[model samples]
Target: MTDTPWLTVVRGTAPLLLSIPHTGTELADLESRLSSPWTARCDTDWWIEKLYDFASGLGATVVRTGISRTVIDLNRDPSGASLYPGQTTTGLCPTETFDGDDLYRHEEDKPDAAEIEERRRTYFDPYHAALQAEIDRLRATHDRIVLYDCHSIRSVLPRLFEGTLPVFNLGTNDGRSTDPALQEKVRGILADTGVSYVVNGRFKGGWITRRYGQPDKGVHALQMELACRGYMREPGDKASPENWPSEYEAAFATPIREKLLTILQSAIAWANG
Candidate 1:
Protein backbone atom coordinates (compact mmCIF):
# COMPACT_ATOMS: atom_id res chain seq x y z
CA MET A 1 0.00 0.00 0.00
CA THR A 2 1.22 3.48 -0.78
CA ASP A 3 2.25 5.33 2.36
CA THR A 4 1.49 8.72 0.91
CA PRO A 5 -0.57 10.87 3.24
CA TRP A 6 -4.30 10.93 2.59
CA LEU A 7 -4.15 14.72 2.72
CA THR A 8 -1.46 17.42 2.46
CA VAL A 9 -1.29 20.40 4.79
CA VAL A 10 0.73 23.62 4.54
CA ARG A 11 0.61 25.59 7.76
CA GLY A 12 0.65 29.35 7.42
CA THR A 13 0.31 32.27 9.82
CA ALA A 14 -2.32 34.07 7.82
CA PRO A 15 -5.88 34.11 9.14
CA LEU A 16 -7.14 32.18 6.13
CA LEU A 17 -7.48 28.45 5.43
CA LEU A 18 -8.11 27.16 1.93
CA SER A 19 -10.25 24.03 2.17
CA ILE A 20 -9.77 22.19 -1.13
CA PRO A 21 -11.72 18.96 -0.90
CA HIS A 22 -12.40 17.86 -4.48
CA THR A 23 -9.09 18.18 -6.34
CA GLY A 24 -8.00 14.71 -5.21
CA THR A 25 -7.97 11.87 -7.75
CA GLU A 26 -6.70 8.88 -5.74
CA LEU A 27 -8.83 5.69 -5.81
CA ALA A 28 -6.77 3.57 -3.40
CA ASP A 29 -8.05 -0.06 -3.12
CA LEU A 30 -11.44 0.74 -4.64
CA GLU A 31 -10.13 0.84 -8.22
CA SER A 32 -11.47 -2.52 -9.20
CA ARG A 33 -14.93 -1.74 -7.89
CA LEU A 34 -15.34 1.28 -10.16
CA SER A 35 -16.71 1.00 -13.67
CA SER A 36 -14.06 3.18 -15.32
CA PRO A 37 -11.31 5.18 -13.69
CA TRP A 38 -11.95 8.19 -15.90
CA THR A 39 -15.70 8.20 -15.21
CA ALA A 40 -15.12 7.84 -11.50
CA ARG A 41 -12.85 10.88 -11.41
CA CYS A 42 -14.52 12.97 -14.09
CA ASP A 43 -16.23 15.27 -11.57
CA THR A 44 -13.13 16.31 -9.73
CA ASP A 45 -12.47 20.02 -9.19
CA TRP A 46 -9.31 19.36 -11.34
CA TRP A 47 -6.22 21.42 -10.54
CA ILE A 48 -8.16 23.80 -8.33
CA GLU A 49 -5.47 23.32 -5.71
CA LYS A 50 -2.72 24.36 -8.14
CA LEU A 51 -4.71 27.37 -9.23
CA TYR A 52 -4.18 28.80 -5.76
CA ASP A 53 -0.58 27.77 -5.17
CA PHE A 54 0.19 31.41 -4.34
CA ALA A 55 -2.01 31.06 -1.27
CA SER A 56 0.85 29.80 0.88
CA GLY A 57 3.01 32.79 0.01
CA LEU A 58 0.19 34.95 1.33
CA GLY A 59 0.38 32.90 4.56
CA ALA A 60 -2.93 31.15 3.98
CA THR A 61 -3.17 27.62 5.38
CA VAL A 62 -4.10 25.05 2.73
CA VAL A 63 -5.56 21.56 3.30
CA ARG A 64 -5.93 19.26 0.28
CA THR A 65 -6.91 15.61 0.06
CA GLY A 66 -5.33 13.22 -2.43
CA ILE A 67 -8.13 10.64 -2.19
CA SER A 68 -10.57 10.80 -5.06
CA ARG A 69 -14.15 11.92 -4.45
CA THR A 70 -15.30 8.57 -5.78
CA VAL A 71 -13.87 7.01 -2.64
CA ILE A 72 -16.00 9.30 -0.46
CA ASP A 73 -16.97 12.93 -0.93
CA LEU A 74 -15.37 14.82 1.90
CA ASN A 75 -17.47 17.97 1.47
CA ARG A 76 -20.65 15.97 2.01
CA ASP A 77 -22.25 15.68 5.43
CA PRO A 78 -21.19 12.52 7.25
CA SER A 79 -24.84 11.72 7.90
CA GLY A 80 -25.43 11.58 4.11
CA ALA A 81 -27.64 14.66 4.34
CA SER A 82 -28.18 16.71 1.18
CA LEU A 83 -26.45 20.04 0.88
CA TYR A 84 -29.22 21.06 -1.43
CA PRO A 85 -32.48 19.96 0.07
CA GLY A 86 -34.87 20.25 -2.88
CA GLN A 87 -32.57 20.33 -5.88
CA THR A 88 -30.57 17.47 -7.30
CA THR A 89 -27.26 16.84 -5.57
CA THR A 90 -24.80 14.03 -5.05
CA GLY A 91 -24.58 12.09 -1.79
CA LEU A 92 -21.72 11.47 0.65
CA CYS A 93 -20.50 8.62 -1.56
CA PRO A 94 -22.07 9.28 -4.89
CA THR A 95 -23.12 6.20 -6.83
CA GLU A 96 -23.25 8.10 -10.12
CA THR A 97 -21.60 10.99 -11.85
CA PHE A 98 -23.17 14.45 -12.29
CA ASP A 99 -24.36 13.33 -15.71
CA GLY A 100 -26.10 10.28 -14.24
CA ASP A 101 -23.30 7.87 -15.21
CA ASP A 102 -22.96 4.87 -12.91
CA LEU A 103 -19.66 4.76 -11.04
CA TYR A 104 -19.51 0.97 -10.67
CA ARG A 105 -19.21 -1.82 -13.25
CA HIS A 106 -21.61 -4.12 -11.42
CA GLU A 107 -24.55 -2.60 -9.61
CA GLU A 108 -23.89 -5.07 -6.84
CA ASP A 109 -20.51 -3.42 -6.18
CA LYS A 110 -22.29 -0.26 -5.11
CA PRO A 111 -21.49 0.66 -1.55
CA ASP A 112 -24.06 -0.28 1.05
CA ALA A 113 -24.75 1.42 4.40
CA ALA A 114 -21.98 -0.53 6.13
CA GLU A 115 -19.35 0.34 3.54
CA ILE A 116 -20.52 3.93 3.47
CA GLU A 117 -20.08 4.16 7.23
CA GLU A 118 -16.61 2.66 6.97
CA ARG A 119 -15.61 5.15 4.27
CA ARG A 120 -17.04 7.97 6.36
CA ARG A 121 -14.95 7.00 9.39
CA THR A 122 -11.81 6.54 7.29
CA TYR A 123 -12.10 9.69 5.13
CA PHE A 124 -14.83 12.19 5.99
CA ASP A 125 -14.25 12.62 9.74
CA PRO A 126 -10.51 13.08 9.50
CA TYR A 127 -10.77 15.77 6.83
CA HIS A 128 -13.12 17.92 8.90
CA ALA A 129 -11.09 17.22 11.99
CA ALA A 130 -7.99 18.50 10.21
CA LEU A 131 -9.88 21.58 9.13
CA GLN A 132 -11.17 22.27 12.62
CA ALA A 133 -7.76 21.70 14.13
CA GLU A 134 -6.34 24.30 11.80
CA ILE A 135 -9.19 26.64 12.57
CA ASP A 136 -8.57 26.26 16.26
CA ARG A 137 -4.84 26.70 15.79
CA LEU A 138 -5.28 29.86 13.75
CA ARG A 139 -7.99 31.24 15.98
CA ALA A 140 -5.57 31.30 18.88
CA THR A 141 -3.49 34.08 17.32
CA HIS A 142 -6.06 35.93 15.24
CA ASP A 143 -9.31 37.53 16.28
CA ARG A 144 -11.00 36.34 13.09
CA ILE A 145 -10.26 33.76 10.37
CA VAL A 146 -11.58 32.87 6.97
CA LEU A 147 -12.12 29.28 5.83
CA TYR A 148 -12.28 29.57 2.05
CA ASP A 149 -13.51 26.39 0.41
CA CYS A 150 -12.16 26.41 -3.16
CA HIS A 151 -13.88 24.48 -5.96
CA SER A 152 -14.62 24.40 -9.73
CA ILE A 153 -16.91 22.72 -12.23
CA ARG A 154 -17.72 22.72 -15.93
CA SER A 155 -19.46 25.92 -17.05
CA VAL A 156 -22.33 23.91 -18.40
CA LEU A 157 -23.93 21.01 -16.60
CA PRO A 158 -27.41 20.42 -17.90
CA ARG A 159 -28.24 18.08 -15.09
CA LEU A 160 -26.88 20.45 -12.47
CA PHE A 161 -27.75 24.01 -13.46
CA GLU A 162 -29.46 25.79 -16.30
CA GLY A 163 -27.64 27.26 -19.32
CA THR A 164 -24.20 28.13 -17.97
CA LEU A 165 -22.51 28.95 -14.69
CA PRO A 166 -20.79 32.22 -13.97
CA VAL A 167 -17.03 32.47 -13.73
CA PHE A 168 -17.22 32.97 -9.95
CA ASN A 169 -19.97 31.47 -7.80
CA LEU A 170 -19.52 32.71 -4.23
CA GLY A 171 -21.69 31.01 -1.65
CA THR A 172 -21.94 32.26 1.93
CA ASN A 173 -25.06 30.30 2.77
CA ASP A 174 -27.12 33.42 2.01
CA GLY A 175 -24.71 35.60 3.98
CA ARG A 176 -24.84 33.38 7.04
CA SER A 177 -21.43 31.74 6.58
CA THR A 178 -19.58 35.05 6.22
CA ASP A 179 -19.87 38.70 7.05
CA PRO A 180 -21.94 40.78 4.69
CA ALA A 181 -19.13 43.31 4.36
CA LEU A 182 -16.68 40.61 3.30
CA GLN A 183 -19.07 39.32 0.69
CA GLU A 184 -19.48 42.84 -0.61
CA LYS A 185 -15.72 43.25 -0.90
CA VAL A 186 -15.49 40.01 -2.88
CA ARG A 187 -18.39 41.01 -5.12
CA GLY A 188 -16.77 44.36 -5.77
CA ILE A 189 -13.60 42.67 -6.99
CA LEU A 190 -15.57 40.33 -9.23
CA ALA A 191 -17.46 43.29 -10.64
CA ASP A 192 -14.26 45.20 -11.33
CA THR A 193 -12.94 42.22 -13.28
CA GLY A 194 -16.01 42.42 -15.53
CA VAL A 195 -16.42 38.66 -15.17
CA SER A 196 -19.74 36.98 -14.56
CA TYR A 197 -20.46 35.98 -10.93
CA VAL A 198 -23.34 35.24 -8.57
CA VAL A 199 -23.62 35.56 -4.81
CA ASN A 200 -26.03 32.76 -3.82
CA GLY A 201 -27.23 31.07 -6.99
CA ARG A 202 -27.11 27.30 -7.30
CA PHE A 203 -24.52 26.46 -4.64
CA LYS A 204 -24.99 28.06 -1.24
CA GLY A 205 -21.95 26.85 0.59
CA GLY A 206 -21.58 23.15 1.43
CA TRP A 207 -21.56 21.35 4.77
CA ILE A 208 -18.13 22.66 5.77
CA THR A 209 -19.04 26.29 5.33
CA ARG A 210 -22.41 25.93 7.02
CA ARG A 211 -21.02 23.86 9.86
CA TYR A 212 -17.80 25.78 10.50
CA GLY A 213 -18.89 29.32 9.75
CA GLN A 214 -19.56 31.13 13.00
CA PRO A 215 -19.71 34.64 11.67
CA ASP A 216 -20.82 35.99 15.00
CA LYS A 217 -18.11 34.06 16.81
CA GLY A 218 -15.23 35.03 14.49
CA VAL A 219 -14.62 32.19 12.00
CA HIS A 220 -16.12 33.17 8.67
CA ALA A 221 -16.41 30.50 5.96
CA LEU A 222 -17.13 30.95 2.29
CA GLN A 223 -17.18 28.66 -0.74
CA MET A 224 -15.81 29.89 -4.04
CA GLU A 225 -17.11 27.73 -6.90
CA LEU A 226 -15.38 28.66 -10.11
CA ALA A 227 -16.46 27.77 -13.62
CA CYS A 228 -13.77 25.70 -15.37
CA ARG A 229 -13.63 27.99 -18.40
CA GLY A 230 -12.17 30.79 -16.27
CA TYR A 231 -8.94 28.87 -15.78
CA MET A 232 -8.83 26.03 -18.32
CA ARG A 233 -10.35 25.17 -21.67
CA GLU A 234 -13.76 23.51 -21.50
CA PRO A 235 -15.79 21.92 -24.25
CA GLY A 236 -18.29 24.32 -25.84
CA ASP A 237 -21.01 21.73 -25.34
CA LYS A 238 -21.44 19.31 -22.49
CA ALA A 239 -18.23 17.54 -21.56
CA SER A 240 -17.87 14.02 -22.96
CA PRO A 241 -15.46 11.26 -22.05
CA GLU A 242 -13.37 12.19 -25.08
CA ASN A 243 -12.91 15.98 -24.77
CA TRP A 244 -12.91 16.97 -21.14
CA PRO A 245 -10.59 18.04 -18.35
CA SER A 246 -8.06 20.06 -20.31
CA GLU A 247 -4.67 20.40 -18.70
CA TYR A 248 -3.91 23.44 -16.51
CA GLU A 249 -1.89 25.88 -18.58
CA ALA A 250 0.03 28.68 -16.88
CA ALA A 251 -0.52 31.21 -19.62
CA PHE A 252 -4.25 30.44 -19.78
CA ALA A 253 -4.74 30.62 -16.02
CA THR A 254 -2.58 33.67 -15.41
CA PRO A 255 -5.43 36.20 -15.56
CA ILE A 256 -7.76 34.23 -13.35
CA ARG A 257 -4.96 33.72 -10.84
CA GLU A 258 -4.38 37.44 -10.57
CA LYS A 259 -8.04 38.13 -9.84
CA LEU A 260 -8.23 35.25 -7.38
CA LEU A 261 -5.16 36.57 -5.58
CA THR A 262 -6.77 39.97 -5.28
CA ILE A 263 -9.95 38.40 -3.94
CA LEU A 264 -8.13 36.38 -1.30
CA GLN A 265 -6.04 39.33 -0.25
CA SER A 266 -9.10 41.51 0.07
CA ALA A 267 -10.84 38.90 2.19
CA ILE A 268 -7.82 38.68 4.48
CA ALA A 269 -7.73 42.43 4.85
CA TRP A 270 -11.39 42.45 5.67
CA ALA A 271 -11.04 39.67 8.21
CA ASN A 272 -8.17 41.44 9.93
CA GLY A 273 -9.82 44.84 9.69
Candidate 2:
Protein backbone atom coordinates (compact mmCIF):
# COMPACT_ATOMS: atom_id res chain seq x y z
CA MET A 1 0.00 0.00 0.00
CA THR A 2 1.57 3.26 -1.12
CA ASP A 3 1.25 6.17 1.36
CA THR A 4 0.73 8.88 -1.24
CA PRO A 5 -1.97 11.12 0.24
CA TRP A 6 -2.73 12.96 -2.98
CA LEU A 7 -4.04 9.95 -4.94
CA THR A 8 -4.61 6.19 -5.04
CA VAL A 9 -3.70 3.77 -7.86
CA VAL A 10 -4.94 0.21 -8.05
CA ARG A 11 -3.14 -1.86 -10.65
CA GLY A 12 -5.23 -4.36 -12.62
CA THR A 13 -4.47 -6.68 -15.49
CA ALA A 14 -7.33 -5.59 -17.74
CA PRO A 15 -6.73 -3.40 -20.76
CA LEU A 16 -9.14 -0.79 -19.38
CA LEU A 17 -8.05 1.99 -16.96
CA LEU A 18 -10.56 4.02 -14.95
CA SER A 19 -9.65 7.60 -14.04
CA ILE A 20 -11.76 9.06 -11.20
CA PRO A 21 -10.42 12.58 -10.99
CA HIS A 22 -13.07 14.66 -9.18
CA THR A 23 -14.47 12.14 -6.65
CA GLY A 24 -12.07 13.21 -3.91
CA THR A 25 -13.18 15.25 -0.88
CA GLU A 26 -9.85 15.74 0.88
CA LEU A 27 -8.96 19.43 1.10
CA ALA A 28 -5.89 19.15 3.29
CA ASP A 29 -4.93 22.61 4.69
CA LEU A 30 -6.51 24.21 1.64
CA GLU A 31 -9.92 23.91 3.29
CA SER A 32 -8.97 26.74 5.63
CA ARG A 33 -8.54 29.04 2.64
CA LEU A 34 -12.13 28.51 1.54
CA SER A 35 -14.92 30.80 2.62
CA SER A 36 -17.25 27.79 2.46
CA PRO A 37 -15.35 24.55 2.68
CA TRP A 38 -18.43 22.42 2.21
CA THR A 39 -19.61 24.24 -0.90
CA ALA A 40 -16.13 24.19 -2.34
CA ARG A 41 -16.49 20.41 -2.39
CA CYS A 42 -20.18 20.45 -3.15
CA ASP A 43 -19.45 19.89 -6.84
CA THR A 44 -17.49 16.75 -6.20
CA ASP A 45 -18.49 13.62 -8.16
CA TRP A 46 -20.09 12.47 -4.90
CA TRP A 47 -19.56 8.81 -4.10
CA ILE A 48 -18.50 8.20 -7.70
CA GLU A 49 -15.55 6.11 -6.63
CA LYS A 50 -17.81 3.78 -4.70
CA LEU A 51 -20.37 3.89 -7.49
CA TYR A 52 -17.79 2.32 -9.79
CA ASP A 53 -16.23 -0.03 -7.23
CA PHE A 54 -17.06 -3.08 -9.34
CA ALA A 55 -14.42 -2.10 -11.94
CA SER A 56 -11.63 -3.60 -9.87
CA GLY A 57 -13.27 -7.01 -9.90
CA LEU A 58 -13.33 -6.82 -13.68
CA GLY A 59 -9.57 -6.20 -13.57
CA ALA A 60 -9.74 -2.57 -14.68
CA THR A 61 -6.95 -0.47 -13.19
CA VAL A 62 -8.28 2.52 -11.24
CA VAL A 63 -6.39 5.81 -10.80
CA ARG A 64 -8.13 8.25 -8.49
CA THR A 65 -6.97 11.54 -7.01
CA GLY A 66 -7.81 12.24 -3.37
CA ILE A 67 -7.16 15.99 -3.69
CA SER A 68 -10.27 18.06 -4.18
CA ARG A 69 -10.94 19.61 -7.60
CA THR A 70 -11.12 22.92 -5.67
CA VAL A 71 -7.43 22.43 -4.95
CA ILE A 72 -6.54 21.77 -8.60
CA ASP A 73 -8.63 20.24 -11.38
CA LEU A 74 -6.64 17.42 -12.89
CA ASN A 75 -8.87 17.39 -15.99
CA ARG A 76 -8.54 21.05 -16.95
CA ASP A 77 -5.98 22.35 -19.42
CA PRO A 78 -2.73 22.93 -17.56
CA SER A 79 -1.91 26.03 -19.67
CA GLY A 80 -4.96 27.84 -18.21
CA ALA A 81 -6.98 27.67 -21.41
CA SER A 82 -10.71 26.93 -21.14
CA LEU A 83 -11.86 23.51 -22.32
CA TYR A 84 -15.20 24.93 -23.43
CA PRO A 85 -14.01 28.07 -25.17
CA GLY A 86 -17.20 30.17 -25.18
CA GLN A 87 -19.01 28.28 -22.43
CA THR A 88 -18.78 28.71 -18.67
CA THR A 89 -16.39 26.32 -16.95
CA THR A 90 -13.90 26.22 -14.13
CA GLY A 91 -10.17 26.75 -14.47
CA LEU A 92 -7.04 24.75 -13.61
CA CYS A 93 -7.55 25.74 -9.99
CA PRO A 94 -11.18 26.68 -9.53
CA THR A 95 -11.93 29.70 -7.33
CA GLU A 96 -15.66 29.15 -7.54
CA THR A 97 -18.22 26.37 -7.29
CA PHE A 98 -20.37 24.94 -10.10
CA ASP A 99 -23.11 27.35 -9.01
CA GLY A 100 -20.72 30.31 -9.49
CA ASP A 101 -20.27 30.89 -5.75
CA ASP A 102 -16.93 32.25 -4.63
CA LEU A 103 -14.78 29.80 -2.77
CA TYR A 104 -12.41 32.22 -1.08
CA ARG A 105 -13.55 34.82 1.40
CA HIS A 106 -11.23 37.40 -0.12
CA GLU A 107 -9.19 37.89 -3.29
CA GLU A 108 -6.02 37.66 -1.19
CA ASP A 109 -6.88 34.09 -0.22
CA LYS A 110 -7.13 32.93 -3.83
CA PRO A 111 -4.27 31.13 -5.46
CA ASP A 112 -2.12 33.37 -7.60
CA ALA A 113 -0.34 32.42 -10.83
CA ALA A 114 2.71 31.15 -8.93
CA GLU A 115 0.60 29.09 -6.56
CA ILE A 116 -1.43 27.62 -9.42
CA GLU A 117 1.76 26.60 -11.19
CA GLU A 118 3.10 25.02 -8.00
CA ARG A 119 -0.17 23.10 -7.60
CA ARG A 120 0.18 21.90 -11.18
CA ARG A 121 3.57 20.49 -10.26
CA THR A 122 2.45 18.95 -6.99
CA TYR A 123 -1.06 17.60 -7.69
CA PHE A 124 -2.01 17.78 -11.37
CA ASP A 125 1.16 16.36 -12.87
CA PRO A 126 1.40 13.27 -10.68
CA TYR A 127 -2.19 12.26 -11.40
CA HIS A 128 -1.65 12.31 -15.15
CA ALA A 129 1.73 10.68 -14.82
CA ALA A 130 0.09 7.80 -13.02
CA LEU A 131 -2.60 7.58 -15.69
CA GLN A 132 0.00 7.62 -18.45
CA ALA A 133 2.06 5.01 -16.67
CA GLU A 134 -0.96 2.74 -16.41
CA ILE A 135 -1.76 3.28 -20.06
CA ASP A 136 1.79 2.40 -21.00
CA ARG A 137 1.83 -0.63 -18.75
CA LEU A 138 -1.43 -1.92 -20.18
CA ARG A 139 -0.56 -1.11 -23.78
CA ALA A 140 2.54 -3.31 -23.54
CA THR A 141 0.41 -6.30 -22.62
CA HIS A 142 -2.57 -5.74 -24.89
CA ASP A 143 -2.92 -4.69 -28.50
CA ARG A 144 -5.43 -2.04 -27.44
CA ILE A 145 -6.26 -0.24 -24.18
CA VAL A 146 -9.05 2.05 -23.04
CA LEU A 147 -8.63 5.04 -20.76
CA TYR A 148 -12.08 5.60 -19.29
CA ASP A 149 -12.22 9.00 -17.61
CA CYS A 150 -15.12 8.86 -15.13
CA HIS A 151 -16.91 11.99 -13.89
CA SER A 152 -20.30 13.26 -12.71
CA ILE A 153 -21.91 16.62 -11.97
CA ARG A 154 -25.07 18.24 -10.73
CA SER A 155 -28.03 17.56 -13.05
CA VAL A 156 -28.70 21.22 -13.55
CA LEU A 157 -26.46 24.26 -13.16
CA PRO A 158 -27.96 27.09 -15.18
CA ARG A 159 -24.82 29.09 -14.63
CA LEU A 160 -22.85 26.44 -16.50
CA PHE A 161 -25.44 25.31 -19.01
CA GLU A 162 -29.06 25.91 -19.89
CA GLY A 163 -31.78 23.53 -18.63
CA THR A 164 -30.97 20.02 -17.39
CA LEU A 165 -28.15 17.74 -18.52
CA PRO A 166 -28.67 14.29 -19.91
CA VAL A 167 -27.98 11.32 -17.67
CA PHE A 168 -24.91 10.26 -19.65
CA ASN A 169 -22.70 12.79 -21.48
CA LEU A 170 -20.17 10.87 -23.53
CA GLY A 171 -17.14 12.77 -24.74
CA THR A 172 -14.71 11.35 -27.25
CA ASN A 173 -13.34 14.80 -28.07
CA ASP A 174 -15.70 15.04 -31.03
CA GLY A 175 -14.55 11.62 -32.25
CA ARG A 176 -10.86 12.48 -32.02
CA SER A 177 -10.16 10.78 -28.70
CA THR A 178 -10.96 7.16 -29.53
CA ASP A 179 -11.72 4.72 -32.27
CA PRO A 180 -15.06 5.42 -33.98
CA ALA A 181 -16.11 1.83 -33.49
CA LEU A 182 -15.48 2.03 -29.75
CA GLN A 183 -17.59 5.16 -29.45
CA GLU A 184 -20.39 3.48 -31.36
CA LYS A 185 -20.20 0.43 -29.12
CA VAL A 186 -20.68 2.44 -25.94
CA ARG A 187 -23.41 4.52 -27.56
CA GLY A 188 -25.17 1.35 -28.63
CA ILE A 189 -25.22 0.10 -25.05
CA LEU A 190 -26.65 3.38 -23.79
CA ALA A 191 -29.26 3.27 -26.54
CA ASP A 192 -30.41 -0.16 -25.39
CA THR A 193 -30.95 1.14 -21.88
CA GLY A 194 -33.41 3.75 -23.21
CA VAL A 195 -31.72 6.35 -21.02
CA SER A 196 -30.89 9.95 -21.85
CA TYR A 197 -27.45 10.47 -23.36
CA VAL A 198 -25.55 12.79 -25.66
CA VAL A 199 -22.46 12.25 -27.78
CA ASN A 200 -20.08 15.17 -28.32
CA GLY A 201 -22.57 17.31 -26.47
CA ARG A 202 -21.79 20.03 -23.93
CA PHE A 203 -18.76 18.04 -22.69
CA LYS A 204 -16.49 16.85 -25.52
CA GLY A 205 -13.87 15.46 -23.23
CA GLY A 206 -11.29 17.33 -21.14
CA TRP A 207 -7.50 17.46 -20.82
CA ILE A 208 -7.00 13.83 -19.87
CA THR A 209 -9.19 12.43 -22.63
CA ARG A 210 -7.87 14.85 -25.25
CA ARG A 211 -4.22 14.49 -24.30
CA TYR A 212 -3.80 10.75 -23.77
CA GLY A 213 -6.28 9.35 -26.27
CA GLN A 214 -4.23 8.36 -29.27
CA PRO A 215 -6.07 5.78 -31.28
CA ASP A 216 -3.21 5.38 -33.72
CA LYS A 217 -1.00 4.64 -30.73
CA GLY A 218 -3.41 1.93 -29.57
CA VAL A 219 -4.56 3.93 -26.52
CA HIS A 220 -8.24 4.80 -26.85
CA ALA A 221 -9.69 7.21 -24.29
CA LEU A 222 -13.27 8.21 -23.58
CA GLN A 223 -15.00 10.20 -20.87
CA MET A 224 -18.44 9.51 -19.41
CA GLU A 225 -19.84 12.50 -17.47
CA LEU A 226 -22.97 11.40 -15.69
CA ALA A 227 -25.54 13.64 -14.06
CA CYS A 228 -25.46 13.02 -10.29
CA ARG A 229 -29.18 12.47 -10.29
CA GLY A 230 -28.63 9.18 -12.09
CA TYR A 231 -26.94 7.69 -9.03
CA MET A 232 -28.00 9.91 -6.12
CA ARG A 233 -30.67 12.30 -4.97
CA GLU A 234 -30.39 15.76 -6.55
CA PRO A 235 -32.84 18.17 -5.02
CA GLY A 236 -34.79 20.16 -7.53
CA ASP A 237 -35.58 23.92 -7.39
CA LYS A 238 -34.87 24.33 -3.69
CA ALA A 239 -31.33 22.99 -3.78
CA SER A 240 -29.07 24.91 -1.45
CA PRO A 241 -25.64 24.16 -0.08
CA GLU A 242 -27.17 22.81 3.12
CA ASN A 243 -29.86 20.72 1.40
CA TRP A 244 -27.80 19.54 -1.55
CA PRO A 245 -25.56 16.44 -1.79
CA SER A 246 -27.79 13.73 -0.39
CA GLU A 247 -26.21 10.63 1.09
CA TYR A 248 -25.25 7.60 -1.01
CA GLU A 249 -27.57 4.63 -0.87
CA ALA A 250 -26.55 1.57 -2.91
CA ALA A 251 -30.14 0.47 -3.41
CA PHE A 252 -31.06 3.86 -4.83
CA ALA A 253 -28.27 3.58 -7.40
CA THR A 254 -28.68 -0.10 -8.28
CA PRO A 255 -30.43 0.52 -11.58
CA ILE A 256 -27.89 3.07 -12.77
CA ARG A 257 -25.04 1.02 -11.35
CA GLU A 258 -26.13 -1.99 -13.37
CA LYS A 259 -26.24 0.12 -16.51
CA LEU A 260 -22.77 1.51 -15.75
CA LEU A 261 -21.43 -1.97 -15.22
CA THR A 262 -22.65 -2.98 -18.65
CA ILE A 263 -21.01 0.08 -20.18
CA LEU A 264 -17.69 -0.67 -18.44
CA GLN A 265 -17.85 -4.30 -19.46
CA SER A 266 -18.45 -3.21 -23.03
CA ALA A 267 -15.34 -1.04 -22.88
CA ILE A 268 -13.31 -3.96 -21.60
CA ALA A 269 -14.67 -6.23 -24.31
CA TRP A 270 -13.85 -3.63 -26.96
CA ALA A 271 -10.32 -3.21 -25.67
CA ASN A 272 -9.75 -6.93 -25.64
CA GLY A 273 -10.99 -7.18 -29.21
Most lDDT-accurate candidate:
2
Give all candidates' CA lDDT scores.
0.90, 0.90
Pairs with steric clashes in candidate 2: none
Inter-residue clash pairs, candidate 1: none
Cα TM-score per model: 0.97, 0.97
TM-score of candidate 1 versus the correct structure, residues matched by position: 0.97
Provide the lDDT at 93 for model 1. Answer: 91
lDDT of 1 by residue, 132-231 (tens): 9899999999999999999998888888888889999999999999889888999889899999999989988998889999988799998999999999
Per-candidate RMSD, Å: 2.0, 1.1
RMSD of 1: 2.0
